[model samples]
Target: MNRINAHNLACPIDGALLVCHDKQLRCEHGHSFDIARQGYVNLLPVQHKRSRQPGDSKEMVAARARFLNSGLYEPLASRLARITSALVPENRKTSLMDAGCGEGYYSDTVFKYLEDRGASSGLSFIGLDISKPAILEAAKRNRQITWLVGTNRQPPVTPASIDIILCVFGFQSFEGFRHILKPGGRLVLVEPGPDHLKELREVIYSEVKKSRPQDLTPVMETGFSLVDEQSFQYKTGEISKHIIADLLLMTPHFYRTNKAGREAAAHLEVLDLTVDIVFRTLEFQNP
Candidate 1:
């Protein structure tokens, strides 16, 4: 029998209760969503869609996959796995939803870790991204997990159904997240620390601006209380010029970097990339 983690879901269309049963999730108004053969459920409603395709492009997805597979961010993934594992209940089935799950690198890694510990049967992993190409690539690489082309603003699950919600280096919709997570359900958010990618910033611009890390207070204000927090740092080895260019294009820094900056990065010898990864675990609180 396939046991889906359905506690963190809600009807995407009307914000009503969603019943996940017998491989189908049905809302009170007779709207039904089928669970894909590959084990993922698509909760994106047509009205919420603004574009034919969304989120990261194929180029960005490929570049991210390459960079991640190069082991540049293994430590970050490991840290996330450890934290997520600790949150699972001992006997009950668990479900994890990765919002903006780009290319499935982090989701696949974490799911594998849990599965290796005999937690596979009790856990279901869902990777949701707005980009159809990203969802396609993720589904191709990790067939065991569910991948959906959807947005964080309108996740396709039932309200208060998920046990864990993960947002890694992607946009977050706190209200949407709060609505989907069960009471006491945990939200694991990974964001770039202040010093993240300092090397790349240095090479791309004459002066690097030291921006403050994201303020979680706003999220807290939306009814999430911080339960735990941690930070990890590591250095990634040299990358090819072409890969480096792709990395720049896939990141927010690309827009900030000027033409001269791009030319400078294009001719760099090697980049000593540094990653400052911050992890925060939050629990839903009453609004």
Candidate 2:
């Protein structure tokens, strides 16, 4: 197996090949970025930023780290590992990128699972997120994986160089993904199913509304054809108050629910949560 590192990164400003120097990445025409001591780089340029601080906040990331580390979502992580590992190109160096990987929980688990299954020899991993705090926490998960603070609109990677990209409940542009994924590359998206967290929503919202399935038409229009999709659902029979709190803090519902809704959730001593998620694999239809 060839040892191909995750050096297929590009300058966020000028899109030139980034060569690593001592604790820094430098591209031709003098674009440079310093790698943080925690083993990640800030590839997001200020000009491309929508705000001074973007994506998940520090508190949110901390909550996510706590919740994910609890192994409550181990089933989902296992499914992700199985899907991604099977997509690894036979006997060739494969590059996997987790776009919008928050704190790298899923990516780290999947990467390690692949490694333990003997795929690490020819696999390179990159975890990118717009949130600095999220990427900072992600960097601590695995030093071998390249973690970068970046966004989906302008991913700091070489065009047409990636083999697989995993976007888990993240906002993204399939058209932009087309530029980074090579011909026949696989793009896996994990989305929340309609019944996901229904129990929690029932308690928080005044009236629970069913969620619609993600539309695939727009994604197909972006030159991606759906390959396969699978759904996973399970119930956590009984979870404690703190565990529920951690779950809430890690999700968008933390902000979406108002004070009364939050108070309703907090008052519950025990809760049963149904975890429903979908994993969809799409192939880029190169012209």
Candidate 3:
């Protein structure tokens, strides 16, 4: 792990600073998390766990990895990279953390994108997820990124040390996020738009509810102001049955769908999917 990046980590037990010592991250209070052979660390403590298996399952991660690796979401990834790169100036050190980074897809893509753009001023990329399987799969994407098995509620990161926090189609705990980001730091968030996967929803449910835009009042109440916003749609050409299956597994709708709904989706030969996404940037206002 990079020394600077390691400094950004904190103890999950007590939120104390952590030091990398002998292949483990140890805190002043003697709480320690061992580095796994896969080059990631598990920082999730038992008390913080919501369940025995908290986050994404192994099967879900595997399906997501397969789907993402196929480059179906490359456009979204590229857009994220471009937008994020534009936000950071080229001549200064920048620390970016991905909250709930699954399989490290966006993080890896953004890392490479910044490198390609020659913003070499010093980029520290960290990805954290509650799922061990997700972090393990993420580790395979890029060893340079610090992947931690941690939760958004109690992120294993130093307070006010991050420049940007990326929450791409993931959970965002306003309190936790506000605590970790430096003053004036930005949060780049990507969420599903109303029309996102409409066709798939139609197949999965008999009646579809209208999709409403995400309300940011709660986020704004936490002393963050919206800086910019954009919405766009990406339509896939002809998607195969295998890709359709992957899509179903990658989304939350899969678990909520009825037996008949799942059967209908499973029998699909091909589908042309429309992916609508909304991007927003919020900057923290230091008091």
- Point to the candidate with the largest lDDT: 2
User: Which lDDT tens digits does candidate 1 get at residues 171-262?
Assistant: 88887788678888899999888898888888888888765557887778878999999988888777677768777877877778889888
Clash totals, every prediction: 12, 0, 0
Model 1 residue 209 distance off true place after TM-score fit, in angstroms: 1.7
Please give, for residues 33-141, the per-residue lDDT of candidate 3 as tens digits.
8888888999999999999988999989999988898897899999999899997877899889989999899999998888888874488888999999999899888
lDDT of all predictions: 0.80, 0.89, 0.88
Angstrom error at residue 53, model 1: 2.4
Off by over 4 Å in 1: 1-11, 15-42
- Give the per-residue Cα lDDT of candidate 3 at 35: 85
Ranking by lDDT: 2, 3, 1
Q: What is the lDDT of residue 89 in candidate 1?
A: 79
Report how far residue 76 has shifted in candidate 2, in Å: 0.4
- The runs of at least 3 residues in candidate 2 whose Cα sits more than 4 Å from the true structure, single-residue gaps closed, are 1-4
